[model samples]
Target: MGASDTPPFLHDAIWQERIFNGDWIAADGGSHAIVEPATGELLGRCGAANAADVARAAGAARAAQRAWAATDYKQRAQVFRKAAALLEQHQEALATWIARETGGIMPKAQVELREALAHLHEAAAMLTQPKGQLLASQEDQFSIARRVPHGVVGVISPFNFPLILSIRSIAPALAVGNAVVHKPDLQTPISGGVIIARLFEEAGLPKGVLQVLPGGAEAGEALCANPDIAMVSFTGSTAIGRRVAEVAGRTLKKVSLELGGKNSLVVLDDADPDIAAANVAWGAYLHQGQICMAAGRILLQRGIAEAVTSRLLEKAGRLPVGDPMSGTVALGPLINVRQVQRLHAIVTDSVAAGATLLAGGSHEGQFYRPTVLTDVRPGMRCFEEELFGPVASITVFDTDEEAIALASATEGCLALGVISPSVTRALRIVNRVPCGHAHVNDQTVLAEAHAPFGGSGSSGNGGRHGGPADWDEFSQWQWLTIKSEAPQYPF
Candidate 1:
């Protein structure tokens, strides 16, 4: 059956186009269209809310925040557990939507669906850990430092990995008893968001504690500027993130942003091209290179640059690209046509500036063929910018010093992968890369659920959302002191 003939499961009654206030409120104006990027077919439509609607959601979150904050950690954990189970029961539907909307292959979409559920379990487990500490003080005096939720948090997610990234922000915020107003990416909002809202509601989450507002910049701006929201957690472009930080900064609200990346993969001369190429191929092409942490830049040692690049090209050619719903596909289309054009522009500019096109570099209906470029320099669009597509820019480095310099050349510093047969060389490269996350002999995309996930520099702000440190980002530290007796002082 053709993609156009497939039923629009998204338009069903399950997605009750309403804003959560324990009851369905009609969707506000500012309508947006959802499309299947793979075929450029309309999937559904979402009701966009204006500034007033965003404020209403924020207000509801604030009211719920107070009561949720007073709930004990164990009770909060129980709710997350229920949510996890609910997702597990609905895995088939959730995975299908993830594949359809985000244009993710079945395997990758399944992985995200399973991992998202596990994340909720981990968040629930986080509740069991220590939350406060007693400081050493003078006799008969007590001092305590507690990690407390920052009331209402506004989470704005990007289009790539919608389910995973959105839930990452929401899990931590809600786990710590903070009410959250989530604004999913306008491109693929309906499917992932409707599932999330339903699961949370079925899991007995308190109404209004978590609300989904699906729209564009207008809704995002409203949520960010709301005074009731104590913090903003954003994962998108650095340009927008900077603006969000500025606006939130004026309100004195804490902001955590995981933004753009031109992340690099450094392969040493001693590395085996077979292993390095395979790992790099997966990192660069997974989800059609839509991932922000993808290794778009490859700093190859001059001795083995050709061998590694050749192997990577061979692997990239074999990956099947088609509709994400098909089980046999390895890669899917870009999230939308705009993404396809942006990636093409990056490659076109790079080639025009003297970079060599090493492999596949074509686009068709939002689908970008896996591509690699050689001789990429600092000024080229592919080298300096974030190409959120399946294009890898390879540059040869004569020495370790040169490799480190190339990795650090970009404004983004989210993650880097150092591949070397020698542990010493891998350690050296990992230490030198100026990024928040680094991997040795592996792709940068391999993230453990308990490890910190965020970036440094323009790639992100200094905050994490998926590790033991995640709770720390959504919370504020409060110090309390008690005195056993009053002391008399004489001047």
Candidate 2:
């Protein structure tokens, strides 16, 4: 059979259910069902942890940190290596579970799983790198700095990339000898949280070093505010992340927050509309546009706005929207009914604000048709808000300056994509956009595991996964100084 012939429900499996410590017993309380967004079919049920549960998980993590930290760096690297190997060995099953539970198609789900494993492998290799640096001096004295792991980290993960993002945060924190208390987004608890737990166990990690407390926002808040937690690493909305930062700051704990974005894709006059259409359509509609880096707004040169908009609409209309387990289905449902309502509100508010919908402002079940809007202004919700759905809004720009101004107007700027034939123009726009990640020839959603990734402004205040920098995030630098000859009698 061809790739399109792959069956639905291909990756469903019984998740291993257990408590790594007594704290986990309290953490695993209420239950919630994981549903395939494409078909509204139940994938599995996961525990919906409460504030008490988060506290328990935090206690477990705190209890485990000293032992994990005291282990040799090489030993920790070995555990990461073993986890990477196990993940590779079970790639098929993991990918399948992701596709079924998160409503990610087989190809996309497989890519994320592979990327997650590859990144973990890179983390394993990076663990061997020497920490800090030695400063050269005229005398025989030596001065150096070394990095040490924090005690315990609380990880709050999002749903769009339940496996990779969650593991991306947890692995680096754990590899650096910091135990982690993870609270996964409710929409993908089983797929991300449970699968990762299985890998950690298989790698022979000591019990209580990594705990998964699956639940909603309250659980995350509880985890973030715990005084026993040494740090909080969160990936979600900007407002919530700010609250987390506040709590962490009040308690004098460290924090890293990767928040929301109203990212943009700018197509210049000289660019190819066909290519631009393809990239924008995929960027806006993939995973139903639930990605944090989704191109929420598109700025087109007036010369090509109408044509590019037309082509983009046609491409989006042709995309398959059905059961996510179906290999041929390109578009899936929103994560839940609440997300559906949010998308509706964005569209409704945009229309009420005088923007016109060119296509699709409707929904049935959790499946929303790809929507496009025109005549959008700077203040409209569709143009300003982080509508985490397959919705795109367009406004024509006369010059590069105008495009840059419009793109930078939002408080949140994570990633920017500029399509221009001239390298100089691309570089110019890249410099103008106030974002952490910039793509010259492609869409904003494009990312590599080894590349540095984060956001500026409201997008992210803390950094996690991304190339060599990930190691820096997980470890703290401490300066070490020693004199070779007692400073030659204090001369």
Number of clashes in every candidate structure? 0, 0
Kindly list the per-residue Cα lDDT of model 1 for residues 190-245, writing each as its tens digit: 55466677678777888889988787788888888889889999999999999999
Strongest candidate by TM-score: 1
TM-scores vs. true structure, each candidate: 0.94, 0.92
Residue 175 error, candidate 2, Å: 1.7
Question: Whole-model Cα lDDT per candidate?
Answer: 0.82, 0.81
Backbone clash pairs for candidate 1 read none
Off by over 4 Å in 2: 1-28, 137-140, 462-464, 483-491
The numbered model that scores best in lDDT is: 1
Model 2 steric clash pairs:
none
After superposing candidate 1, which stretches have Cα over 4 Å from the reference?
A: 1-11, 483-491
